[model samples]
Target: MAVALSTLVEEANRYLNCAAISDYCPNGLQVEGRPQVLRIVSGVTASQALLDAAVEVNADLILVHHGYFWKGEDPCITGMKQRRLKTLLKHDISLLAYHLPLDLHPDVGNNVQLAKQLDITVEGPLDPSNAKVVGLVGSLAEPVTARDFSRRVQEALGREPLLIEGSAMIRRVGWCTGGGQGYIDQAVLAGVDLYLSGEASEQTFHSARENDISFIAAGHHATERFGVQALGDYLARRFALEHLFIDCPNPI
Candidate 1:
């Protein structure tokens, strides 16, 4: 069965509540192709490798958490951006992207999906005052040391995380996936004993040492891999479309 690309985008926007949230990039149908879609390829980013994979699979639509045209990005379609767009246009594949909306979705969100994998019992948003807080504060099933927590993250994400130890034991935890090292301060203020994020900034080590909070810099791609896949699977099931999740591995 085939579905119109516009209908799929509408369903996704509604499912993810895309319109309500503000993001740096446009959240739906960044690049339009065929109106009718039968096969979809989903991934974390619409990089060249992923686009090639989608083309190989004969995908009619490609969905991703990260897509082209960011807020401050170079508007001119030259160099890398040019090549990426050329591939999509050449292949006639529609590109559907969701940024903050994918990360903030409660059930299929990056934070909640990671929490489920790590056995974290969520309590509330890390930034409680903000209605659209992307980061979350939660508790582990039981208190574990910084080392043990890092191990848990490694086991869950299939990649060993860079660790900054804080205490002998940790209970309360806070996390945000994909380049949210800045949110560590908010988590610190939220009183989480341990904080996890997709990537770590240079200041993150000092922040952990000073704040007495543990930190784990799980690879950005590793941490964010689940959300887009989850969203894709849900859509595939709902729409009866054949979907494949392509993982273009990134060590970062």
Candidate 2:
């Protein structure tokens, strides 16, 4: 049996528990498509490559971490923006996106999934006040050297991670899966031995040295792929719809 696009989106919103807050873009059903959805495609970003892959698979719905209609973007649809939307609309493929909700979900979130893959048991959120915070505080099953942890991240994600080791061995760790170098301070204050994130800025090295916290920059796209894949699998099982996760290699 095929699932309705509206039904799948409603189920996702409830399962992710995303109805509480105001988001930059609409969380579900950004573009209308066929009434009955049989195949679903998931990806990190709704780029042209992803869209093309979804089209190739004849996906009725496309779910992504990054979607259209960001806060600071121009409302006028033209150029690349028009092209993306035009492709989805022309192909009758619905677009469903979950941003912060997907990032913070305890089970299927990027941080939690990354931690699980690394054999880290999540203790709690790094920031208690902000429920939307993507970083998580967790402890390793056993203490491991910072160098070993760095290599493990590289091996798990299939990308060499940039590591800035501190004096301490890593057991307690904090991680945010994508572009989350800013959360290092929170991790340091939380008394974690290491801070892991997808991307690092020029100042992250200085922050790591001064703050005495080990830092690791695993590839942004590599670290973030797990959560959406988990979510897609859950959705597929729940609704019995066909789901595929398409990975687009991103260096940064």
* Tens digits of lDDT, candidate 1, 1-252: 999898999999999998799889999999999999999999999999999999998999999999978998789989999999999999899999999998888999888899999999989899989865689989877888999999989999888999999864989999999898998889888989989999999999999999988999998999998999899999899899999999999999
> Best-fitting candidate, measured by lDDT?
1
lDDT of 2 by residue, 105-205 (tens): 88898888898899999999998888666688999888999999998998899888899999999989998988889888888889999999999999899
Q: After superposition, how far is residue 235 of candidate 2 from its true place, in Å?
A: 0.9
Clashes of each: 0, 0
Whole-model lDDT per candidate: 0.92, 0.90
Give the runs in model 2 whose Cα sits over 4 Å from its true position.
none
Per-prediction TM-score: 0.97, 0.97
RMSD of 1: 1.0
lDDT of 1 at 148: 90
TM-score for candidate 1, residues paired by index: 0.97
Clash pairs, candidate 2, are: none
